[model samples]
Target: MRLSTYEIILPLVGTDEKPIEGYTLLTNGLYGAVDVVPKEDADKLQAGDFAGLPAALRERLMLRGHITRKDEAGELADLKLLSRIFKTIQGRSGVGLVIMPTYDCNFRCPYCFEQHRLKKGQDWLDNTMSDEMIETVFDALKDYRARGYMVNGCSFYGGEPFLAKNLGVVKKIADKCREMDLSMGAITNGYDLETYLDFIEEYKLRSLQVTVDGTAELNDRRRLHKDGLPTYDRILRNVELALQRGVRVNLRVNVGKENLHGMKDLIDDLKARGFIAKEEERAKEEEELRKTDPQAKTKRGQFSYYFKATTDDAHPEKNISEQDTIDEMMKIGFTAEEAVARQSQYNMIWNRMKNLFKKEGYPDFSPAYCGAEMGMLVVDPFGKVFSCWDVVGKDDQATGYIQPGMSRFLWNFNKAKWRTRTVDLIPACQSCPYAFICRGGCASRSSNAYDDYFREFCGEIREIFAFTASRLAGQEWEKRRAAAAAGEASMDACAGELTLSLAGPASRFTEAERAKIMETNSQKEMFDIVKGAAFFPEPE
Candidate 1:
């Protein structure tokens, strides 16, 4: 038997007051199991040198998948299985329609990538999506529904989706989604949200991802209006109103050198304004709301914040290293663990895996990382369709387009390329231990910035994973010890069920289709990293 590729091993150290020996922490990234084993046994198991270990110990490892009899060919087979499962899921999943109604945003944030284009005298206002294009989007959605796919939801995107000029277009799309019983979400600047309360309630807008940057005073310096007016207070008020009406508000802060430290202040402001509530407090409030008014939408769906490190390849002067940005969060107030977790997407996944958080069930295992694949398409203002929001404005990135009188959408290889981007297909990721979780990292971002699908801004993904696993392992160990002291039989017995399941109709794949996917072809060779066409020209 051999260890799984997803295993992460770390030295099991004792408390700071004392020292312990002959133990190591073995964690399985896939199965989410952490165990402390004798150093000698660990060494033997790792080296496939199981000579002196007891049968019980060996059986336990094998059952947990810490040790498996699988050979290299078996490992490859597992990956193929996973890839097929992903493809099956992708085939049946709901189609995400991201509509960019306009390219003109009111915000004049200095760090915005689009601002560089604005300075170059680009007439983005004139490029707004025509009414005919909006009609085309509805036609496309109908086509998807006719093809046996659910029109899952609509996401309103663009320069600033909430801009006054775009309100009519927003209302049109929102009304259509409501008519079809689909949820609606938006990525807006949040300045004019007060004007959309009717649309929000009538259309059942579920979520709004708005940028706050930092606290009121600090954020106002960057997230300003086109006329240089401060927008912090207006945004805060609007977000608060949305929360009161049962909308989930996600405050996306662009963490950089300037606003990194200010994040703490912003978080504190949110706490004071009732945007964040402690677990017990939130539970009490929710119970009270249920008792008083059973039909009320929410009592705890206020808002939460996420941090993204600022990057502007079109203007390198605005970029900051991920390490530096994360360090600033730690220097200000967050612990190293919190800093790392909050700075990344799906931060709750770490806690869920470690058995600390349980609000949502364990994450469902799916190969699709983002909307770029699985037909989550973006229809730009000009009727150009791209695979993801990140590639909207670039003409070269558009997978297809709709002409004024065309009865159907055009097709391209870009959409097909993204459709096949599974973890096993990435050259740099194929042999990497964290391939499943990383999932080849934002394809458009990697391709745009580094001209390679697997490359990231920092290549420190492994380090981040290692740090996260170690911290979670330590937390789990302490919890188990506490349970033992309290006379519990074992922590595992009370830890509740954890499930890992594949997505969609894998059982229904025809043998012919399976054989075609299983064949070794040019698609396999496409994994090799290579720079091809530059979608955008260099700035003068």
Candidate 2:
């Protein structure tokens, strides 16, 4: 038997505030199984000397697939098989349709990533989607349904899809969506949302992602209009109107070094406007409601917000690191947990892995990072189709296009290239322990960084994973410690029970074969170690 190549070992702390002598928290990133084990046994297995460990411990490890038979099909092959299975399942699920009416925007944000497309002047900006093109897009959706793929929903996107000029186009799309029985949503700046309120109410608009970077003063300094006008009051008022009309609002804060410290002021403004409530206020209200109504439940708010670090490759100096943003959030009265949850894209992978561990003790296998590779079709104003939203206006990046007369999509080689950019195809990710979890990171970012889509764009993933695992291990250790202190079961008993529940069947290798395998490779190569380190500041 041999140790799995996908295991991460972290030192476990004891109840007495000291590092446990020889115990370590071992987590298999591929399987998402976590356990506490003796460091000596782990070392033995790492050295291909599994027979030196106790039989019970060895059996438990084998059951969890942490230790496998030497002759068994390798983990890389298993990963590839899982990738193929996931891709097949996703293909049969549905397709996401993104409609970009125009690439023109009233506001000129300093850190906008679409500046490359926006700088093409009025002639290019005036190329809005015509009524005929809208019909063709729906026709394409019809073709997708005919191919047995469900039309999931339509999301409005663009330089700004909710601009006053696009209201007619927006209504046409909404009318079509209603006829087709598909839901509608949008990612807008919220400046002209008032103009679309009638449309929103008529169609039961599912959701709107609107950005409110900071307080009025700070936000206007960042997200300003082309005519150099302040946009905070107008956007906030429209957002409130949308929420009142029963549409869910996701208020996004594009955090940068300049506005990172202004989040507290923005939160205060939200609370003042009754858009958000303090934890204590919410608790008191819930308690009062329960007294009056036996079946009373806390009201679910129509609006929510999250902080996302700005991505501006042109001006790297203007960007704020995620850790710094989270630190500032904690300083502004957010708990460690709250801060972690509110930070949007930074901890997405870590959050997914953590939630899966809680729900299933293992993560669902993922072949690709996002819907772009699976079934997302982003159609720009000119009917240019792109797999990823990041490369929407770039002609070379477009995977296909929808002609006025063609009912079916005219796909090119780029679509196949995107569809096949799975974790298995990336050389560096093929044998990496965190391949399934990270899924080779963002495809657009990878292409930009390495100038090749196939190259891996790691982007601080190792540090993020190590930090998250360390925090989880610390929490688990404390939970066990607390349970023992209350005259409950001992730590060893708790660990054994957890192992049995997580581990499945016995090893495929027999005793004789296992012993021979162990003795053959006395100096086996160790898996890459990710040290348990803190990337974010610890809460006081």
Candidate 3:
């Protein structure tokens, strides 16, 4: 009879047996022990029941399961530990994916990379994706079951994706997604707006970053048809109709010196419509609420906060501070009283936001991620899978295209390719300092604007980041203001309230003392000081 010896590890969650430094534990403090058993009886005295032990030893035997498939209990525990560890490290959550259905565009905008398609002329058309070709795309997505990703379905695009005259195409895709109940939608520049009305309302198109080159005269000049005809008026009409029907519309402007003038006009047009819709919706909601709860009176500027990036890099109250917003409000409203009133409301909104930020987590914060890393396989209108939307029609170096049926190409990158892509990846496109949450900016736009994929629109992004962060900070400030807004209170009451909110009451402990206390009491501090530390945070 053969004899086998095995040592089992027991995890000690609540013990002094902490891990050593640098080498973090895959499993926690496991007590040590070994057992000798006959091969024929190996299964009987394994894990839960081990052979030959005193009652005290039996209670604390620390049976670390075998690291093999023969120990089914050990194997199951290993898998569970693996799953837990994976979740902790990878987050393993699905992110939103945007599939550009087509790069074929109607308008030949001077700024658009899509115009490059027009410049390349028939080459893009020859390569354009047909409706039938899309089936292969869908099937390829199905083949990726082994990888843990869910395709949110395709976001149709094009030389105006509508140019396909594929109304049935959307319905067919929508029908399949409806059966599967997937998030499917499309982006269009509104050439065939009326036809796609039903699809927009029904599908609830998640995103619509439609390109608006400039104003009526400027836009018409920029976004021209195949024969170089103006399209601003037609597109605007379509946008208006879509908005009226409650289609989600994000008025996008590619800001350059030429079109900066048109942006304000575009905003004015959209805002008037938006405010009118807001008023109607507000009234409807109020009526319904009155019928139901009746006690929700939203103060002015409650929907959105108003604030500007300040000199201190903090979002503060606007009283006597934000002159730019005041000036802009006048232009947006086109009346002095209207401007002043709106500015006041905006200031109040900002105040409320600042107050909220003091105690709450980041609110309405959308991370600015480099869309490339998130597994968005954007197949241009011709069914060419390009990574960068703006890189479409260019050479494979600039454009992110791959052959059909080759591979769905999961975003999990190789080191050589990652380095190469990173070299191609503009430093500006590097992981944002805030990308532990906010992703970096778009690689394609950076490449197109600067001709360096690694270089970024840093100034634009910094301003946006500051602006976004300030708004978040402003929310916290608002909460502080409200807490302080309590009219008449005793000195003790005020002191107590303030002390409760602040990290360490000024009256109780000094900063050094508090810091020591935090370091000592914090769980992270408790475990980190131990022998081994295995994990590191994901790259920022």
RMSD after CA superposition, every candidate: 8.5, 9.0, 19.4
| Model 1 per-residue lDDT tens digits across residues 216-287 | 777888787878888998998998788766778888888766776777788788788766664346556777
Ranking by lDDT: 2, 1, 3
State the displacement of the C-alpha of residue 191, model 3, in Å, after optimal TM-score superposition: 1.6
- After superposing candidate 1, which stretches have Cα over 4 Å from the reference? 11-23, 28-40, 90-92, 115-124, 271-283, 289-296, 299-301, 314-341, 346-348, 351-365, 404-408, 454-458, 490-540
* Poorest 10 consecutive residues by lDDT, candidate 3: 24-33
Return the top candidate by TM-score: 2
Point out the higher-scoring one by TM-score: 1 or 2.
Answer: 2
Tens-digit lDDT string for candidate 2 (472-503): 55556667667887868575645632222222
- Residue 3, model 3: lDDT of 15
Off by over 4 Å in 2: 11-23, 38-49, 70-73, 278-301, 358-362, 473-493, 496-540
Give model 1 RMSD, 1 decimal.
8.5
TM-score of each: 0.80, 0.82, 0.55
lDDT of candidate 3 over 133-170, digit per residue (tens): 55655555555533555555556666566654667656
- Model 1 poorest 10 in a row by lDDT: 527-536
lDDT value, candidate 3, whole model: 0.42
